[model samples]
Target: MKQLIILTLASLFFTASAAADEALTAEVLKEKSLAMCESKASVLPEGEKAEALAVCQCVAENTNYELILEAKKSGDDSVAKQHMEETLKTCKAEDASIGS
Candidate 1:
């Protein structure tokens, strides 16, 4: 039937659109993460500046992009905040060990 064919095509179009949106969201998250790291790193003290930058980079590189996207989609920040806190804690611990 023509209606069935039209429905199938529409479904495919929606699926493709969703995939593209997900990819765009991922790219946006990556850019945001890097920008956040750069801004945070710029304000660190000279003595621990490198370590601080390293921590930020570590956090950015290790964060779960999918979790961030899910949180954003649901309008809930808890997942994203939890990820950030965990990343910071882990990175800080690593940085402390480096200075030891």
Candidate 2:
């Protein structure tokens, strides 16, 4: 009976750990991407308002806190800027992808 209980507890702990890991990964992705997008939007020209808005939308959709922290640490401004631009383009290509 004691052995069975120990095995069950071990299985439960492992299952919970897996779920937490998945959730953390998703959160990280969203945060990092959003920070980059926000920065990009702030720098866009007035004539490109629509595209800038799309960048913000994509960041909201795709960002996570963990990823943003990583990006900040790397100090890769150009890469982040390019990423935001591509995200804006992708949002425009998928109708109804932004401004919802």
The models' CA-based lDDT, in order, is 0.57, 0.44
Candidate 2: how many backbone clashes?
A: 10
Give the Cα error of residue 17 in candidate 1, in Å. 20
For model 2, the local distance difference test gives: 0.44
lDDT of 1 at 78: 69
What residue pairs clash in candidate 1, if any at all?
Answer: none
Candidate 1 segments whose C-alpha is farther than 4 A from its true place: 1-23, 43-45
Using TM-score, give the best candidate's number. 1
Q: Write the per-residue lDDT of candidate 1 for residues 42-96, one digit (tens) a residue.
A: 6656665566667666666676666766665676666666765676677768877
Model 2 CA deviation exceeding 4 Å by range: 1-24, 59-90, 95-100
- Structure candidate 2, residue pairs in collision: 27-64, 29-63, 29-64, 30-62, 30-63, 30-64, 31-63, 31-64, 31-65, 32-68
Name the candidate that leads on lDDT: 1
Kindly give the stretch of ten consecutive residues in candidate 2 with the minimal lDDT sum: 1-10
Residue-level lDDT of model 2, residues 3-87, one tens digit each, is 2222322322233234344543545455544454555555556666455545455445743333333443465544444544454
